[model samples]
Target: MTLRYHAHKPLRHHPGMPETRLAALLSDVIRRQRQLHELNQRRLAELAGVSQATVARIERGDRSPSLPALERLLAAMDLQLTIGVEELDAHLDARLTEQAARPLAEVLDGLGLDRIVDRLGDLPYLLTGSTAALLQGAPLPTDAVEIAVRWRDSARLTEWLNAAYAQRWNARWGEYGGVHIEPEEPGEHRWLTRHGELRAQMCDELPAGIKVRHGDRSYRVVPLVQVEATDPRAADLLRRHRQRQQAAEAPAG
Candidate 1:
């Protein structure tokens, strides 16, 4: 998924720190580390001497832990918290610019999209998210392809992926090797393979899509309007691109 950034605003007490982003980053780190260590909230809380509710709240990003609490939690997992500073958004902006300059077809080819589609054969799928936007000529940078498939079709798709691409279902952070496709919550399942990462949005039924041809292959893609409505990243990119176009055509105002 694309990372969203707000306008540069430093925390008053923390100087360069973006409070919201840092809280999210910290929560993600704590949750992933706990999962990697094979400890649930209760287990981690026991080791860290914190209440299970506290662990849950921190992992949910609803609360920021004090330094003592944070260190204790990290220590239980054999980790140490470290702070570093760099130019915010510099790397991500540069990467996005580089991707934006490349043709969408080239990006798809690099990600082995054609091989994937050919292998899927008759399985129904509609490209979604930024991938769909790119397919619909939105000029968005798509790192990975996302597809929406019916819930009933997920098992067959998983079987095909395993047989064809040796795909492994990503169960948790640094965890894999599930033969079945099970989503913990609605609308999210990811599989990893040598080809690349394939993210599937499980749905009761496939959304309506428009057919578009890319490099001699016709693909069903979620319409630009649908993508804009559903995907925040794609929506933001399209919004900014339209703003730029409007500014350029403003007759030198």
Candidate 2:
């Protein structure tokens, strides 16, 4: 399911951006965005609409990319960076929350469905950008669930996309904001996010939403123990979950 972040309202920018500072920030942002997208030097270079060597140059802050050019790169990777602002932290979680309140599939399916990655499968996904947000429970724009997967053979992506998991998706209909129905289609896998740059990992177990039904008509989710939290994608959620736990343990203030 896709989650909306309190960013990009009218896509405004913060003021007082010196050319030098803007260049530095853009360089850092490009580097981070590429890393989060988990694009390797070559792959990220292609997707960012820049050359691989240029990507390296940009990342090192040696080159100052134009704002429009940078915007294209960011949009391609599904990252919305905030800059030159008096209130960098100011955001409207309310809009995102409202958007998230709607059923994911309902809106996502209508928003031009794209290739989805099923982490439960045998493929390898390059973790980055919005995919990173989903894994970490960081706020994100309401979009389809996305992860870059490494198909053994590029052709294998299509095979997997059409192939359904033996098990049914036992999720509560509309429970999750967006859906990543497994057994993806490879032909549709047009873009491969650079893998491992962000150091994204597999979940030690299944996610909470994953479930199954027994012959006896009983239902179950992928158990917490079976759920692998090692996936860096869940970093934000894990941190938030930890904070909530800590708050609960704190003495009454």
Q: Which runs in model 1 stand beyond 4 Å of their true positions? A: 1-96, 165-180, 183-187
Candidate 1 lDDT tens digits, 1-253: 2222221221122336566666666676777677558787788999999997888767766656787888888888877665544676443444455666887778888767877777778899888987887777666665456888887886777677667555444323223343444443332376655566677777898889999998778988888888788778778777866665577689964
> What residue pairs clash in candidate 1, if any at all?
none
Task: For candidate 1, give the lDDT.
Answer: 0.68
Output the worst ten-in-a-row residue range by lDDT, candidate 2. 192-201
Task: Indicate the residue-level lDDT of 140 in model 1.
Answer: 66
Candidate with maximal TM-score: 1
Query: 132 in model 2: Cα distance from truth in Å?
Result: 13
Candidate 1, residue 221: the lDDT equals: 89
Tens digit per residue, CA lDDT, model 2, 1-253: 2222223243324465555655555665665456556665567657767766666666656657766666667766876544434543222333345545656444333323222332225554433433334333333443334434443433444444334221212122201112342334211222222121111112333233433332332222323322234334344434544555577799997
Q: Count the backbone clashes (under 3 Å) in each candidate.
A: 0, 34
Global lDDT of each candidate: 0.68, 0.42
